[model samples]
Target: MLGHQLLWPVVAIVVMLVIDVIAVPSFLDLRVQDGHLYGNPVDIVRNSAPVMLVALGMTLVIATRGIDLSVGAVAAIAAAVACTRIVESADEGAASAAILACTTALAACVLLGVWNGFLVSVVGIQPIIATLVLMVAGRGLAMLVTDGQITTPSNDAFSGLATGFVLGLPIAFLIALGMVVLTAVLTRRTALGMLIEAVGINPDASRLAGVRARTITWTVYVFAAVCAGMAGLIIAANTNSVNANSLGLWIELDAILAVVIGGTALTGGRFSLAGTVVGALLISTLVRTIPSIGIPSEANYLFKAFVVILVCLLQSPRARAALRVRGRRAASSKAVAA
Candidate 1:
């Protein structure tokens, strides 16, 4: 559905689904209960929503030849700010408090993005180094926000973001889908997509050609933080608590992996939202499949690494060429034997 470029990711997911179906025959059974859908597929999508949102923003950042290592940290800060605000509110359970908490959290994320953007786009720091500063310190900042303790606020309105369903679908997934669509429309329907690619492909050249390269880069960093912020809110809502230390640890790595698996080169240039969608789903499916198929929990990372490495090799042009050369040599040997 996302063209030939997405074939491998799609195939990987399909294979996993097939395996899941065999391992758990009822994997695909969908039952509606209380106006909500329940099943492995639904669960996978729901579970992957936060990652998808982060990856969506990561895609744009990568497309602009930049990285946001601070995304996970930024998410933690956002959750900390939000949950702390709600807990300190006069009415923690009030809808207004939840709304205010969300707004404040996103605003804090925006400011953090501005700081990152300033360092990279304005101060001329390497994206990785610039974001790394925050990555290392953001947890401490979050701890400060919550006094080094977990904040568990009682807010049904906020919790609904993660636990509630709308029209038989997960609200988190729907939010992700909406953001994906909105991002697609804004980038594709306008000249912004080309400008971003141009900057990624060659910043100096694009700047000479009248593209606002720094502006584009800064904007993408900010957007990435906002996406991370939304993801943080969802994660905090899920447990109805915010543990700054663990809110979004290592999620940045997953977002980067999703972007790479989606066929977006780390070196930048082109991007595909649809590919990312498949990639995120693939990652989620792998998580689900591992336990269901009896893989040891201790080896989960290793197993996932193996699969990811295999897929990456399959996707590499040089690797494909080497395989082709081997195939040709084997063919010649067979002919000579004949």
Candidate 2:
């Protein structure tokens, strides 16, 4: 059953890759340059890293029947904090400055997460509303950090995070992969995953069964914020600057789409990290391929929307049943004709 559920998303990714290959023959052309792997495949993975990380956290939050709409804003704020700190440091290129900048930025994000968790868990605000508060305010906070200007910082240690390579692969990709593995291990190897699922599946029932629903909920929100923070850092590092307004603009929607495309229910319950990863890759591929295929920039979003809708329809149970019925009817007709 699980395999069946997961199959369509995998197929969708393959289909998109095929489309990419057809549109741009060199899409799959990979080469080793300067001891590092370089290609479209590499770019897809590297570019999708931020969304992948955000979606990973979104999967957890969604599993708990919650949404963190503020992730993108959190990303902006994180970038703002990190870059502003780096620029302010006298020794901007020093490793110590980079470390401090990252730490401080991530710490701020964690606190923001705590605030989000508090609003939902203690203040009894709806998850959407609670997160919306941050979603709307976070960018403003980021702007304040950057003093309402784009922050350009020159720091090799920071830039190395996004541009550097590790073991012949992009460091960004490696970091994202590492986070995915860590999240999977931390959740699956312990009772945490089960507890979270239980809470997500039925908070009232889980509480009755000795689950700390509040703690689980709060923890997931914090984790989501942390993920957003990390993603923000990656975005800033990639550009070697921070544009608070655009750093993670509308990324929450992308993360949510990734989670949904991966087969995670928006209504909450069970979630899949593997599926989310595939979904993020699918999105990244589309983003990269659209421009190559000569789609007008103005209508690019329309094409994406259409594809998303088609994929969702294909994943629908009713649609699948109808497709099977049609196949059966066609087979019977063929037999009759024979």
Candidate 3:
């Protein structure tokens, strides 16, 4: 069933290659330096890594027919908190200031996650309304964390999460990859998978079947918050500075697009993590290719707009049904020919 899901993407890649050969000629070599790889592909992976984490959590939320538009806010707040604390601790004469800062960053993010969890789980507020409060107020919280000052920190090890590497791979990319694999295992192997799907299909039915529907909903939101927090820290690490207003802005939209493009239905009850990765790659590639072909920056966004529309159209029930119907017809024709 999953292999069937991947068919069109595989075909798309082949078509891209054929087009590249005809038009760009040397398009395969997207390198910018002699040995150092650079350009849109690299930039895509770098920028997309943090969002991938957030999108991953969003995918889970969406699977349950819910949304968390506040992840971007949480991410920004996490970044601000991390930056402010790191700078403050250094000023306070801590011996291992960077370590303290790192701990503080992660701790702050977890606290925010807990707060989100409480509001969504314990308070029983609608996920959209509940998360919206934080979305609006979170930047203020971030500003308060730094006393309304932009935070600057000088730390080598702290920045390494975004820039350094244990192997040749970027740490950001590796972390995102690990999350992809982890989600794959979580949804594919455990009873949690069935429970999540059940909840998505019908909450009342799921509850009657002994599934803790509310608990699942709570967990998904918390998980999403944690991922957003982690992504915030990563972005902070990458840039070494934090501005509450600028960080993680409007990222919720991108996550939804990625999930939908990967074949996950917004209506709930279905998700595909592997498909999400391909969707992310597709997004990254499209963004990268625009400038590679000399398109203007404003026009580049237009390209993204079109691809998003195209992917969403392909995921529509009518389109999916058509594909399945065609596949079944092919099978019938083959049998008759035999």
lDDT of 1 by residue, 261-315 (tens): 9899888888988888988898999999999889999999999998888777777
TM-score-best of 1 and 3? 1
Q: lDDT: which candidate is best?
A: 1
Ten-residue stretch with the least lDDT total in model 2: 1-10
**What TM-score do all the candidates reach, one by one?**
0.96, 0.97, 0.84
What lDDT score belongs to each candidate, Candidate 1 first?
0.92, 0.91, 0.76
112-147: candidate 3 lDDT, tens digit per residue? 667766777678777788888889998888888877
Clashes of each: 0, 0, 0
* Residue range 1-338, candidate 2, lDDT tens digits: 62365677677778878888888888899999999999988998899999999999999999999999999999999999999999999998898999999999999999999999999988889999999999999999999999999899899889988999999988988888899999999889998998989988999999999999999999999999999999999999999989988899999999999999888998888888988998899899888878877899999899999888888778888889999899999999999999
User: What local lDDT score does residue 93 receive in model 2, on the 0 to 100 scale?
Assistant: 86
Task: Point out where model 3 deviates above 4 Å.
Answer: 1-3, 9-42, 91-96, 320-338
* lDDT of predicted model 3: 0.76
TM-score of model 1 vs. true structure: 0.96
What is the Cα-based TM-score of model 3?
Answer: 0.84
